[model samples]
Target chain A: MLTAILIMTGIAIVLGAALGYASIRFKVAGDPLVEKIDAILPQTQCGQCGYPGCKPYAQAISNGEADINQCPPGGEEGIRKLADLLGREVKPLSEEHGTEKPKSVARIDEQVCIGCTLCIQACPVDAIVGAAKQMHTVVAPLCTGCELCVAPCPVDCISMAPLAETVETWKWKYPVHELRSAA
Target chain B: MISRLFNFRGGVKPESHKTESSGTPIDQAPLPKRLVIPLRQSIRSTARCLVEPGQKVLKGEHIGQGEGSLGTGVHASTSGTVVEIAPYPMAHASGLETLSVVIAPDGEDRWIDRVPFDYRKVSREEALGWLRSCGIHGMGGAGFPTHVKLGSGTGIDTLVINGAECEPWITCDDRLMRERAAGVLSGAMILRELIGARRVLVGIEDNKPDAIERMRAAASTIGDDVAVVAVPTLYPAGGEKQLIRVLTGIEIPQGKFGTDFGVQCFNVGTAHAVHRAIHFGEPLLSRIVTLTGNVAHPGNHEVLLGTQVAELLALAGPKADTDRYIMGGPMMGIELQSLGVPVTATTNCIIAASPTLFPPPPPEQPCIRCGECARACPADLQPFELYWFSRAKNFGKAQEYHLFDCIECGCCAYVCPSHIPLVDYFRFSKGEIWARERERTASDQARARFEFRNFRQEREKAEKAAKLAAKAAETRAKLPEAAATAAGTAAAAVAAEPAASPEDLKKALVAAALARAKQQKAAVTPKNTDSLSAETQAEIAAIDARREKRNTQDADKTP
Candidate 1:
């Protein structure tokens, strides 16, 4: 028993020392799982997710504190991807947050400007450009339609506008049999 | 020249309607008053308009610049003044609009200064660069830039010129070979020289003996490198992969090109255009289009690019009952959305639709899982499996079945007893897959942007917190000893000391609880009794007497 105990003690000490060295030598700085989950999200920076931003929501998801269905901007497809990545059962989207809509960009009516810098502060992506008391304009491509800026604006000049489909961006819709019969 | 030609796995024999279009000699189309030239003609095209409205352009003058290395250039088909530069309907299967340059042709049809490149004096790369600027592309429906195709021509062995115009009613290639045999052979020689190939094999379908004879005569005049051979007249024997397989007996691997196997293919019309571009300094401005079906004169015409289909149909004399038009052969053609859409490099045939000649497809029936479609697939793919997966939207399974390997040849559709539009399903699935991939890329980019924004916000917050902490530390360090002692004493007064023992803590807690109970009882005492009526006072006195008696009885019982 003494010999066995001594051998086990020696093995434990060696393994513990190796593990300690490895922990310091090859330390992972950030949570890669959170990073992967964040990568899967639509980077709308639209806090329809209860969290402050996509990264925080991703961190919460990695920590098993947030449900994958809370993000309306990510939509069903995003939820499906997250479920596939995290090995969880797919669930319906939680209706309390919002519903998934077609992609849009936040457009500001520059003419109705009472440019309180409140909107500038609330924007996560910094897509809106303006001075403290001047008119503001939205860079359409960069704006994520977060709607976070809309609540902060006193004049309520900001609104989400659906993107126009050009020939380049047009997608082929599935043909319906009933529709074909009319043709 | 005839060799032991090998056969591919599956192909159907469609009726060759060549005599309908090939009866007469090829004719030159009358220059229209206006030409609406679409800037984009090739796949993944990025043609940028170079001229503004009202700018005078000569015939063969470059009117659009190629935006990317793979983009094809566009030139004026006839000397004309630019009338409009705006979005117009283009001849595409999707019936979409593209940015086009509208030119009103001048009656003179003036030519620009011509400068031909000497192939023997310059490097093959330089010759190809000249060809790139000439706006030449494959006229075999694909419209691929010929320069890019010949870019990888180094160390190639065999160059196969596809002269097999095997589609049912399309005889553009047949007429091009019969009319311009010498020009086609010259372009083939240039191709063979550029690719440094040992031999050039021209595969024309045997049904067109006139084209075969003319091409053979032209080849004999030119040296021994060019051999004009006749392939068996089969539906889609003119297909790039099919013709390659028939001539060389090599099945090009999936997701690979003909050049991957030391072979390359070009259309005879493309060769003729190359000859004109290199020898005559002309760009691909016109193409021989077959105008047949519900037309009085069913023949081939060398129609200028950007000529409206309506104008071309008028020249061919369309029947009064012609309801629609197809841009290519009936087997793989798309119906024209409007007759006003202009033709492009890929428009080889335009069939005016009538009730008798072109009837609507029968209503689709349920797939019986018969293996006939599989046997008829030219690419040797299982059509029923693709059909089921696509219909079910199981794209992953469809992809696993090599759905993209399908050439969209319509062979399976032609042979299907169910009359199902298999090619349409394939096209729809491909478009969906492409759109999904684009969305995935966009999502990834958005994620990066969001992550970066979050990171910046976090860093800013951390910096703010650190600055506040530093400010507080600075203020504390600036205070003298006496002030620090005074601050410490004030802080100590507010901070209560801990209990010394468990008994002391219990006694303190019990005293606090008794005091709280007594305070609560005192607060519940009745108020404002001075305004009571006389009867109320008497009732209160009686209740009080009863309470006192009850209290004495309870006390006695407890004792």
Candidate 2:
């Protein structure tokens, strides 16, 4: 009985020391889990889910502060990816976020526009450029077309325009795969 | 056993008939009278066309320049006249139209006062920038901007000059390194200095002893800054990622770059160009092209940009009645539709061939479980599964199987018992996934923007209603006092004022909606809630107190 007690005590002390050492030695500075989650998120700062950017949404998801379904811009697929990352059930996009639509950008018709720069200030990505009284123009490449600009246009000059596709910008999506035996 | 920790798989291996043309030093092909130089040479947005149609241009004159940091300028391939500017057939199998500037050579390859280099007099950054203006890109296939490659500001510990020339039947780099080892070595020194590396590793395959000796002597003269390390002659040793692995035993993780490993690999040919750019002030306007196979005179040629394949193939001796043409090496080079495919910076080997040079691939058959393909897969992916999945267009499941990981090296198909074109499937799968991702991202962005806009609109509508109601209440309160006898008459007029002006009513509504939106925005934060007017809070508290008091009074009455 005495020998068994001594062996058990020795084993416990060694295990405890090992665990303590490992806790300090392998400690990562930043949360790798959060970094990985952030990497997968689309960086569009359209705040449709009420969060400012994908990183904030990732943080909110990590902290259990926000639902992953709030971002309509992520759409059903994005929500699914977030769900998988968070190990939560995928939920349908909340109707409060509005329905999914094709990507478009706000543009002011130069001829019709009265040199109002309200849209410029309202643009989150700073995709618009014009003086307060100058004819506004959209930097097509920079425009995410969040339509944040459209609401602020006093003259109601800004309208949404569909993005044009070209041969270079077009990339084919990945095809499907069937799970098979590794022979 | 080799540790399969590196999860690369599902590569296709085509018949590598490399030895056919890689036997001797590059020979010269007669320069064509005219060279059609395109403004956009590298993988960047096309340069703006500067010379109008019919404008005379000199050999060293600037044709056009790239827009952003990743772009390189286009120079005259030869003293030429700008003939046309429009989308022309590109050097791709798709025969895709890309914006090109056609230049007709005047044949007088006159020199523009070229800048000669004095190493002691110039700074390294200036040399690199001058090379960019001269338009040097990686000549070993992926024509990434050479300046961009050198400009990676990482504190490189090692400079890897890839002299392996592993791609079969492509000896342009080999020929350049062998004939001009001094120049190639000089370029390596420039790269070493640019990267600030303590050690320079010139990785050459053991196959070329002649080239190895030349480079070894050059490195010795340059002190111990650069060392010539000959690796075992293996196929694809020249592949940038694979070469880094073979030398350093370090895997560059996905989405991470080679510079991340403190090692940047450059083709020996590219290093030669860097030497010319730094030393001679010469832009990469020309390159050594291997012209062999199905030709009467089988030799390598130094080619200028915009030289039609037809012209080179003609110089190489016309293809026989049964001849087919390929660009680059036989293994990875593209098969040309006609000899008309304009030679870009990417073109190194143009394989004009008959059945003897490139036998047609046999009809694909079902896998008999021989597993020869698995052994050949450089990427180690189960291509059999990918093939089935891609055929079904099941991209999600294909991605789950790590379709994005395949480098499309084309090894599995070479050793397959049934020669399946695995690269095509991988490419198709990758393309599909990219398209779907782009589609999803676009739609998601649209939806979010739409919701936010509607929220603004809804708030505007509600505000207008509130403002009008407040205005009506104000008018009604003052009407009776202001007009005692004409109280009812004035009341009607006041009501008309609120009803008559639709524009004013809309503006007032929008203001009210803006206030509501501000309130909604504030609800999400503690600061916003705390900063709310005390009166509003008191009113809410009072309403709650009144409801409680009324409920108690009602309860007492009920008893």
Candidate 3:
């Protein structure tokens, strides 16, 4: 009986050492869960989730400091995706954060722009290009519709214009079944 | 000679209503008063518009030059003055407007100087480039640039000319082969010579006997080894992959080209266009359009590229009860929003849809797992599962079921007992997946830019700090040297004062710099508002308060 017990202990100690060595050798730097969560989050960098950016918000979520429903730019769909990823129940988007709106890009009224670079400094994605005391223009394709630039504009020249549907951008809508609806 | 043919998977045999339009010979459509030519005629990059508003252009003038290798040139159909370059309704299902060059015809169908080149005299690359400049695209509804397909002809062994006009009520190809079989054969021979293919096979549906007979006669006259084989009459037999399979017994997998299988397929109409461009030095300015369905005279007419659909219908004597127009054929066609849309390079047929002739589809019923769609799918994909996944917005699951393999063929929908628009669901799923992918790419780009901006700002701050530190060290070094020099020249008491510790001197410098910055800030005052009146100041205060309130409201509204 003593021999069996000693043999079992020996096996346990060896396995423990192997696992300990593995933990050190294959140690992953930074939280991979945060990177995954950040990927799922629409990288709008709008800070609508009460965080500085998407990465910080992802870190907060992984730390259990922020709720999955706090992201308004991601909308209810995003909440569902996060819930699925984290194995949590899907919840409605939090109203205190904001409401979901159609994707848009910021447009600056060049005539009204007072040659101030305040909007350029305020852009999160650096989509606005200008120098000090120079008229600024927003690169429409890059602007994440963050609205961060609009408030900082001294002349209030910036406006969010919803993307227009063209032939290339047109999408086929979901098919509605009348018979199923009646049933 | 009887060539061994291969059969494809599930397909449906719909009633062919082609007899109505196939009886008459092809006729030339009258020149439209104004032609609205869209620059994006091919499936790839759009052509760059060369003519501006009010510019005079002769017939066959290069109005839009091809942008890239995949792009094909666009030509003026008739002598006209460019009226305007603006967005006009296109012959697309979306009914969206595209940039179009509108030209008013000058009643003179003047031709540009035509210099027909002998392909035999020039290098193969030069010949292909000539075809690109001629704007010869596949007239088989895909509008793929002919040059790109011919350029990738290194490993191609068999060239299959698709004459299988299988879509119901569309006989443009059938009419073309019957009337201009020699031209089609000549073009095929040229293509064979260019690609250096050993054998040429022409696959025509058995339903169109006249086209087969005429093509065979033309092949014998040319004394070339072009086999005109009439395969079984099957719907979608004219499909590029399907026709390729029927001719060469090769199944090209999804996301792969037919050249990988040592075969290349070209439409019969495309072959004719190639002939006209190479032999006659003519660009693809007109195509044989089948004008049928709810029209008094249902026949085929060689219509110009930018002819308005309404004007083409009028020539066919569209019935008064005609309610709508459908482009292409019944199986794979889009209901045009308005007849005012211009005919593009891909516009092969225009069916005047009416209530009595073509009734609306019955209300869609839930799928009972009947598997009829699966039985009718030519691509052999599971349509029912795709429909369910797409409806649930589970794009990942839909993709898992090989959703992209679906060619948007209406066979599944055509056979579905529930009358579900299966193709529409597939299209919706594909569009959503593409759109999501595009959004992801854009977001990735934005994230990179944001991170780079942050990195740059941090770098700038570090650079400034380093410069300041270097300046302080230089000052410190100079002070010690000066103090040593003073010790040698004057009394030792000056150097014996402990030299005022470097820490103390650095602290004093920082304090002095801060004090100077504060003085500068105090000196800078408001220039315009310095001498403002009391009323103006009050008004400015009120405006500031209002602005503050509005900003908060705006922030609240932002998502």
Candidate 4:
């Protein structure tokens, strides 16, 4: 009986030591999953989610400290993608922050500008180009319509304008009813 | 000669209403007062409009130039003055708007400088450039650029000229072959020489015996290298892959072009255009369009590129009770939203749907999984499964079933007991998938830019901190002996951070956190409101009073 007990104890210790060594040897170095989640995000850096930027929100999501629905700029489609990735149930976008709007870019009125650099500092994507006491202009293509620069502009020159769709940017709209109207 | 032919997996043979329109010879459609030519006519590319409003353009003069390597040129069909350059209805299923140049024809069918070249004497590249400049593209349903198609015919063994005219009630190609067989055959020979092909086969459906006889006689005059063979009558047998398979007994693999198998196919009308561009120095300004169904006269007419369909229908004598107008054949056509849409190079047939002739399809019913659609699918895909997944909006599942392989032929729809509109579902699924892919690409770009911006910000912060530390060290080095001691401690505090211990690192982190918290607290303080108006000052006082009252009320409630 003692020998059987001793064999059982020896087996447990051997397995335990093997598992412990394997755990240390095969430890994951970096969180690739968080990187993937960050890539899926729209990356507007709007700060509407109360996070400083998209990366901080991604980290919070990975750590389970923030819900996927908090991103207003990302909207419902973004939530659906996050749900698919994290294996969670899809939820409606959190309405307390904002709602999804058509894509827009911030346009700064050059004529009304008082050469202040506050918007440049407020921009997360560094899309605005200017120096201190110099008129700033928003690079149209690079601006993410995050609306972060609007609040810091004391003159209120920055306004969101919907992106004009050209033929190159036009996408096929679905035919809702097969027969629309007869000739 | 290809003695034995091959068969595709599945196809349905619809009733051929060819004799309705094939009864007479081709007619020249009269020019309309105004021609609204869309800037984009080719499927592969959308040309950029070169002419502005109020500009006078001669016949065959370029109005739009190819914007990309794969695009075709757009020319003025006749001498005209540009009236407007704006968006108009396009010949698409969605009837969406596209930019067009509306021209008021000057009533003079004058020609630009016609420069026909001996294709044999000219280099292949030169010939292709001429064709591209002439706005020559396949008159087949897809409207692929002829130069692009010809460019892929290198080292081709068999060049198949598709004269099948398989769809019912569309006899444009048939009439073209019957009337201009010599031109078509000459074009085929030119194409064969250009591509350096050893064998040329002209495949025509057996139903059009007249076209077959004419094409055979024409091919006989050309060497034994060209053979005109009649293929079996099938719904989509004229499809590039299907015709290639039927003629050469070779099946192009899925998601591959016919050229990949050392075989290339061009439409009979496209061949005629090639011949005209090389021999007669004529640019492709017009094509044979069939106006049929519920019209007094159902026949072929050589309609100019920018003429409105309403004008063409007026000549064809449309019945007063016509219900609708379809652009192509009944199987693979789009219903016209308005007759004002112009007839581009791709408008082969316009069927006037009437209550007595063509009726609306019955409402859709649920699928019982009978699998008739699967059997009728020409691409050999399971249509029922595609239907289920697409209806459920499970794009991944639909993709797994190879949803894009569907040819949108409406063969399954014709045979479906449920009248499922299977092609519509497939198109919707494909569009949704493309939209998602575009969204993903945009998101990826945004992410990269955002990440780069963040990295730049971090680098700038580190550089600033390093510069500040170096400046402090430099100032300490120049300080006096009494002050140098104090400055030396400050320099040491900056330099000592390089080799910190675990305890020191923790303390440093705590100190940094405290400093950041204090900085944030300081940043929250309001400032720079010294010169406020009386109205603003009263508003601030009212807000302060409300806050004080809320605090007192909260205190009372707690007690």
Best by TM-score: 3
- Most accurate candidate by lDDT: 3
Which RMSD values do the candidates have, in order? 18.3, 17.7, 10.0, 12.3
What would the TM-scores of all predictions be? Answer: 0.80, 0.66, 0.89, 0.82
The residue ranges of model 1 lying beyond 4 angstroms of the native Cα positions read: A1-40, A61-64, A79-93, A107-159, A176-183, B1-3, B123-125, B459-559
TM-score of chain B of each: 0.83, 0.79, 0.87, 0.84
Interface RMSD of each: 2.4, 6.4, 1.5, 3.3
- Rank candidates by lDDT, best first: 3, 4, 1, 2
Model 2: chain B TM-score vs. truth? 0.79
- lDDT of candidate 2 over B34-112, digit per residue (tens): 5666665643546776788899888778888877886777888778688888776667655556777788777788767
Model 2 CAPRI quality: incorrect
> Candidate 3 on A1-183: residue-level lDDT in tens?
999999999999999999999999999999999988998899889898999889899999999999999999899888998999999999999999999999999998988988778888788899989787677888888988888998988778989999999777788887764445544
What TM-score does model 3 achieve against the real structure? 0.89
* Tens-digit lDDT string for candidate 3 (B1-559): 4458899988889999989999999998888988989988743458899998989999999998889778878899999899999988888888888888999999999999998879999999889988988888888867888888886558888999999989999999999999999999989988998898978899999999999999999888775567999989989898888888887788988778788888888888889888888999999899999999999999999988899988888889989898888999998899999777988767889999899988999888889999999988888799999999999889999999999998887999999999999999999999999999988998899889888988998999999999999997876666534444433444234444565776755544454456557767999988998999999999999999999999999999996
Per-model DockQ against the true two-chain complex: 0.27, 0.13, 0.59, 0.23
Q: Residues B197-306, candidate 1, lDDT per residue (tens digit)?
A: 88899999899999999999988887776788888888889899999999989899889988888898999989999999889888888999999988999999989999
Residue A15 in model 2: lDDT: 100
Reported per model, the fraction of native interface contacts reproduced equals 0.41, 0.18, 0.78, 0.35
List the global CA lDDT of all models.
Answer: 0.84, 0.71, 0.87, 0.86
**lDDT by residue (tens digit), candidate 4, B189-239:** 888888778889999999999999999888888788789999999989988
